[model samples]
Target: MTDHGPTREELPFPDYDHLPITGLAHRIRSLDLAQLRVVIEYEEAHARRVPALQVLQTRASELEAGAEPSGGDPSALAPELSPAPSAGSSVSPATAPGPDIPPTESDEAKPPMRG
Candidate 1:
């Protein structure tokens, strides 16, 4: 019988090199102090890579210590680049309402249907 070598389907390691490090760093930087702790815990459990873990741990510590700038602050090394909401804007009606369907006009006070 001929020996059948392991196929690519049997590859043991997942390819992480292709992951977008810059994008991840931006997201991590945006996390609040509490959320950052959760992310750090997840990183420790799964990937556990030294360099990446170090970066996350350092940022988390800085946030916990109140030494880190807010993610949106331009002074931050990796500033949050997400768009900012306009000031004094009310919450949009669609999202403000709960998952339940909103009441129809019939449910509210209405002038009797015009002829």
Candidate 2:
């Protein structure tokens, strides 16, 4: 296949090389078979990362066997990957409350733990 200059940056995850194996599998759930093939070809041609290629190949097989894409929306993240939250009422951790701040007490007024 003539690569014609398609780069890793053209992938759904431009940082695909940086993704952990588990993360790669997770992100691949958002891809259709065609998109998956683009990645597999890219990996074979340029980076040639064996582990990643295996994952892509496995997933592509599953797709060929009639498994459906998670229907994950591939537009909500990574500027290219768009995995939408599966539920309407999903509360992302980004929207969750942070740690509670302890009330400030005057240093002199605080009782010491020592005897």
Candidate 3:
């Protein structure tokens, strides 16, 4: 059998910043043993501040001990800010997908001949 390795979903890294403290905490109260090691390493290298590091450590302990940490809904943390795309006149030709070339040439397609 061919090995595809692990998919992105299988990976432990969280996607959005909002997820680290909220969504991810609910999903996995504590990091897995292996993942804890990674978190410690990342925390040491980047965020050495006490409060953030303490939070990670606390979550790590909870995971090791099997307990849930309290946090807000991941969805509730961030408002859905994207505006809907405007209709018709606002649409760009580049974004409109098709085979590109016109199926048939019209009278306007011909250029005037020069003397």
What CA RMSD would you report for each candidate?
17.7, 10.4, 13.4
User: What TM-score does prediction 3 earn?
Assistant: 0.36
| TM-score for each model | 0.40, 0.57, 0.36
**lDDT tens digits by residue: candidate 1, 2-96:** 13333322222112222345545555565676655555555555566777677778887877778654446312333324435678767688658
Give the candidates in order of lDDT, highest first.
2, 1, 3
- Model 2 bad stretches (over 4 Å): 1-5, 74-115
- Provide the clashing-pair count of each candidate structure: 0, 4, 1
Question: Which sections of candidate 1 miss by over 4 Å?
Answer: 1-19, 68-115
The alpha-carbon lDDT assigned to residue 89 of candidate 2 equals 62
Tell me the tens digit of each residue's lDDT in model 3 across 11-42.
34544323344334443343465654455555
Task: Report the poorest 10 consecutive residues by lDDT, candidate 3.
Answer: 1-10
Candidate 2 clashing pairs, residues 3+ apart or interchain: 73-82, 74-82, 75-82, 76-82
* Residue range 17-79, candidate 2, lDDT tens digits: 656666688789989998888888888877777888899999999999999888675434554
TM-score of model 2 relative to the true fold?
0.57
